[model samples]
Structure formats: structure tokens, C-alpha cells
Target: MRRLDPRPCVVAVAVLAAIAALTGCAPDAQPGPGPAASETVASPTDAATPSSPTPTPSPTEPALDPDGSAEDNLPLFTEVVEKVWKTDDRVKGRAYIDALVRAGFDKASMEVTKDRSSVGIPADSIQFSVRWTDACLVGQVGPSTKKPAAVVLPHLPTGGCLVGETRPIDW
Candidate 1:
């Protein structure tokens, strides 16, 4: 009778044990959920009851303006401006104005600085604003500016969107 080789058997066992340990299949490891049972499950009587359908607002319904005051809408305006501004570094003046317009700001009441200067040099900063009844919601973004900044300040009694300097939107 040929003698059985125990060396090969020991090496094979060691390899399998190492694989199991590496794969987290140790004997004490907890098992996860298996396939669902073949039996049909039953729900409680209360759970099976049908409830009245809730009415959902239509998509065409206009969204409620944030209190209709620029001060009250400062936070919302800031959030929207930040989201739009971060989308691209090369965003132009019209992009910010358009985004604010889409966010329910009146286009006729909005103003934006040109992306370039009178000499056609790219502006270091750009400003956009919405002229509200008593105040203005202004947002400025650019290399010279910190993160997207927004503010609600009293409208210039002189009749302008912002009090600070802003380039003309010639572009």
C-alpha cells in the first residue's frame, strides 16, 4: 500500500484557512440576510387598510416668495447664488443674472456688471442684484471676493440697485 502524503494535505488546509481569515469567514463571523422565504407573508389588519389619497400641489403652481422682502430672502438668495457660482469659474455676468431670474427674481428689476472692462479686460469681480421694494438682494463673486457673498441693504434712495461701484453690462 502506498503511504499517504500528509505534507500536501497540511499545505492545502493552511491555504484554505488563510483564505477564510482574509475573506472574513472565520467560524465566529455573523451571517447576513439570506434569500427570502418561499412562504407568502401576511400584513396586520390596520396596515392593510386603505387611506385617503393626499392632495399634491400642481407643478404649475408658483412657489411662495421668501416673504416678498429682500431682507427675508437674503439667505435663500445667498444659497442659490452660491450653488450657481460654484458651477464654473469662467461664468459670465449674464449667467448669474439669468440664474437669479430663474429663481423667481424679476428680470426687469435685476442688474449685472459686465464680465469685462471698457478696455475688454476680464473683470476681477462681478456683481448681480435684484431690486426689491425696500431693499436690494446683491451677490458678488470673483477672485477678489471671498466665497459667494450676498446682502440685503436698503435701496439707494437715488434709484439704483447697488450703492457700490459696478461696471456697466455692455457685454
Candidate 2:
């Protein structure tokens, strides 16, 4: 019998497993009810299970976790970012800061970039952030970005998320 290489076979199996995982055919997949699934009465414990975060806000608002990881609060953070992006002040850094404050994120924990450049031209984008524990929830929006985006990122070694100068969240 001819000797065969095992590495190629291992790589092929890994690729297949990844494809299955992404396509939801993996053995450990645990998806929630589909759009057409019928709703039924459930025990109190099962009533509001959040298996995965929804892109849109739920009928009942999600609250910020004061001590939880930044990733856990990203859905709410993204909701606020998206909400602000739909408004007339989408490019205004202050609008993002105010909305985040109203949404219950700490004003002291936030930082935002200027809406305009030193020469007074409108900036291509604005970045805002809220520090949560050891992580930061960062958001960017404006003409350059084309769409609002939010994500959980690790804090910089020197501290804070935005570089250069950031304006105060003072009202």
C-alpha cells in the first residue's frame, strides 16, 4: 500500500467542519425559533431567554450591565448608534454623546471626536466610545463610514479608545 499524507486529510476535514458550522449544520448548533415559529406560554424562567442578540431593539428595552463585559452590552450600544444615525444630526458628535447618556451609559465613561476639522470642514466620520470594565464599546458613523457601526474592543495600553484629542461629554 502506498503511504498517504494525513495533513491534507486533516485540513479538508477542518474546512468541512467550518463550512458546516457556518451553515448551521454542525452538531452543536442552537438556533432560536424561526420567524414563523408559533409562540406559546412558557415558565417565567424561559419567558425572555436571549440566546443571541437581535439587531433591532426588543419591545422591552435591554438594560446596560454595570459590571458585565463590553461584548454583553454591544447590542444596546449598537441600537443607540443606529438610532442616532437615523436622525438629522447623524454627523454630529454631540448627538451621539447625548443619546448614549440618555440611554443610560455613563457620561464620564464616554469620549468622542470632533465633528469638524481644525480648518472647519466637516469630518469624514466621528468616533465615540464608552469604556466598560477592561473593554470599550466603540461606535463610528458619518459619510465616510456609509453606515453606523458598533463593536466591543479592548482598551488601549495607554488607556481610552480614540486617539488625538476628544471633546468632553459636558452638556
Candidate 3:
């Protein structure tokens, strides 16, 4: 009869013991009950059932167009400014403020800059704005302002069209 080596048996036992220790499994460990059968696990199909629905805009809030373009609303803003534009060769910030106010924009939420540079020299451009929600409808008009444009932009937190200074609308 052949005798098995005790050293091989000892090494095998040591290797199994090391593996058991690393895996945190013991001979006396008990298995616990898992998830209930009634519980439905979420899958890719469940994504259709959103946890929360998209909020509906209030009556007073302007809704984004179904086409998903803010440009659809651009006409509403432009009309307000263009209706007040003068046919004469010159453009003024005051006219923009008056026109926007007449068109239902809040006067207190409007900003305009004098037709002059920061150094008090005559500027070729003048800017005006109407604060709308988180944005500003800005209008630029002057010889150098390049063909009179109106653009919508995020308003500064301090609340104005430009950084550091605006002319008071005395009228």
C-alpha cells in the first residue's frame, strides 16, 4: 500500500483555510432569506415610469415652443423694440425704454446706457435692456453698433445689461 505525503495534505488544508478566511465564509454561517417574490426589481422598461413628472408651466409663465426653440419667442421681444424704433437717422436709448414700457415691460426692470463711452466721450453705440425672468432682452443701436440688433442674454446677478454703470432713465 502506498502512503500519501502528510506535507501535501498539510499544504492543501492551509490553502483552503487561507481561502476561507479571505472570503469570510465559515462552516457554521447561516443563509438568510433574500428579496420577496412580490417585490419587482426595476429594469430598463421601468424607465418609462418616471419617479416625478415634468412640471407644467403656470398660466402667467411663458411656455417654450413645442419645437424646443427659444427663437420662436424672439419675435415677441423684437416687436416690442422695433415698434419704438425711429425712422430718423439717429437712435436713442430713451426711445427703447419708452417703447418697452408701453409694450408692458416693467420700467423698474429696464436699463439703458448713455450714448457715450466710459471716458465721457461720445460713443458710437448705445445699449438698452428689459429684464425678463433670468434673462435680459438687450438692444444695441448706434452708428458703430452695426445694423441695430436685439439679443436675449442672461442678466448679471446685480441686475443690469452691462457691468458697472448705466444712465438713469430721467424721463
**Best candidate, TM-score:** 2
Ten contiguous residues with the weakest lDDT in model 1:
59-68
Tens digits of per-residue lDDT, candidate 3, 102-155, equal 666678877888877878777677788866665677777887855677888887
TM-score of candidate 1 versus the correct structure, residues matched by position: 0.56
Assess each prediction's global lDDT (C-alpha) against the native.
0.74, 0.88, 0.70
Quote each prediction's TM-score. Answer: 0.56, 0.64, 0.51
Query: Using lDDT as the measure, which candidate wins?
Result: 2
For residues 33-133, write the lDDT of model 2, one tens digit per residue.
Answer: 64455766666877587667668855977678777789988888999999999999999999999998888899999999999988999998899999998
Give per-residue CA lDDT, model 1, range 1-171, as digits (tens). 999989999999999999988889545456766547985555696567657766876754334275667777776678778878778743477877767777777777777777777788887788888888888888888777767788887777778776556655443
Query: Model 2: what TM-score?
Result: 0.64
Q: Which segments of candidate 3 are over 4 A away from where they belong? A: 1-73, 118-121
Q: What's model 2's overall lDDT?
A: 0.88
Clashes of each: 0, 0, 0
Report residue 45 deviation for candidate 1 (angstroms): 26
Of 1 and 2, the candidate ahead on lDDT is: 2
Of the two candidates 2 and 3, the one with more favorable lDDT, higher being better, is: 2
